[model samples]
Target: MIRAAAKNHKDVLVVVDSQDYPRLLEFLQGNQDDQEFRMMLAWKAFQHSGLYDCAVSEWLWKQPTVGGEYPLSFAVPLSLKSSLRYGENPHQTAAVYVDKRLSEVNAGGIASAIQHHGKEMSFNNYLDADAAWNCVRDFNNPTCVIVKHTNPCGVASRDDIIEAYRLAVKADPVSAFLGYTASTIVDPVGGVGGIWLIWDPTQVSVSAHIANSQLIQATVKRENFKEWVLAAVYASPNPGIRQNLWNDLENTSSLMVRPWLIAGTILPIS
Candidate 1:
């Protein structure tokens, strides 16, 4: 009716907000050409209608047949989580909504995540990140799950979480770089390029530890800084210290390379 009156070039008075009662009375007295006031009311009317329609649709979706999927009359009310910059595409306006009950106690899910850094997450990012989180959480060991378009591109669980991540990235490097990655265990021993060396501190001791803006290296040793096995590498993105990082890696590799064999009783973790 509001659009029809506007199209017909007639004076239209839309009432969607009770606060506008004063304005409506003023317009009734002598202001009929109040296009701005009418337009504002029209906008509110449309937004309210859209939300009501969404609620009705959700309620109807819950209705089930005698033996069909949906069960009975009920409502599934969702509260907004956030307004996204864009939805599945730029053309659509979108917001993420969550079930408040689930979100309240969600300790580690994406819905309850507190981002430490990075640009605003998109709708698709939430979907893919949630997928990666779900998959990675299922494993007890160190695991990496890479999800693209809400599907797993790479997933690996290993005795070594770093090795698991390496295998996952090797499984599909291009996709791994583009998609969301969720890792269950990241070795606290930091290294270069956001990389980490994951090791069992109970089985070995740290002989020497090294860290630069670009990398971190730790020499794994026997009982008390004795002979060792191998060195772990993590490279940072800082190009300012490339030469220093390379020299350190080379020196460590050349000086620490040694052949070691292991033969031991194996007990598997469930």
Candidate 2:
């Protein structure tokens, strides 16, 4: 019937067989001669058949049981919401989706995050943010988490937000450079190397002096000086982490403030 329709120059063909539907569609979609596509179709068919066989076996196994003991079946539905800017790297494509079942029960997952500012997030950002957010969320006290490559390089919990951040950074200052910090408060002081700060901006405030002084006397006294002082701030709903503390110096100059937020959590107020 399909060949007959094609012989007659039909514009489209509708295939109804579950077993051949995917392959037919793939063939019509210009993958007719692709070996990879053929292999993928075969694998998918095998998986589908295997699942059906498993279901039948499960049913048969339950039929012989006297006490009606059977394995429970579970299904999770997911919906794609948007595509990420990129995967771990720029060459890879990525997307974000939400589990319908889980989203109903939990309110704090990545799918619920709100971006206040900044450029589109990458796959690594979501991964790193999730790691940092989960770590800080587990701590009740003011905490700071500096994540480098999906691992926490520095983490500290303290009553003082600034002190917690300092202690976290002090844990592994070198690794903390260009790392992501998740905490309840963050300060945008200079001297501390580049870092991505993520926290709840509503719970933090900038000091008048520290906010005014971008470069302080202590930063100048440092032997190894970097041209750029601080990196970006992300305002999230998670706990806030503090930034570096600026020394009270008469000759300190005010820092240029940039307002940016990493989507989901962590934000810097200008």
Q: How far is candidate 2 from the true structure (C-alpha RMSD, Å)?
A: 14.6
The estimated TM-scores of all candidates read: 0.39, 0.40
Query: Candidate 2 residues 161-260, lDDT tens each?
Result: 9999989988996777533343222222322222333332343322222222122111111225332232233232222222332222212334433331
Candidate 1 residue-wise lDDT, 1-270, digit = tens: 644543443355666668889977887898447777767777766665556776777666656633346545544546677888667875567887765656667663886677798657778889999999999999999898877789888899999988998788777767775323421122121221234344445566654356444444455576765565543443333444444656876776677656532221112212
Clashes of each: 9, 21
Worst 10 residues of 1 by lDDT: 183-192
Q: Lowest summed lDDT over 10 consecutive residues: which window, candidate 2?
A: 213-222
lDDT of each: 0.61, 0.53
Off by over 4 Å in 2: 1-73, 100-108, 178-270
Off by over 4 Å in 1: 1-71, 178-270
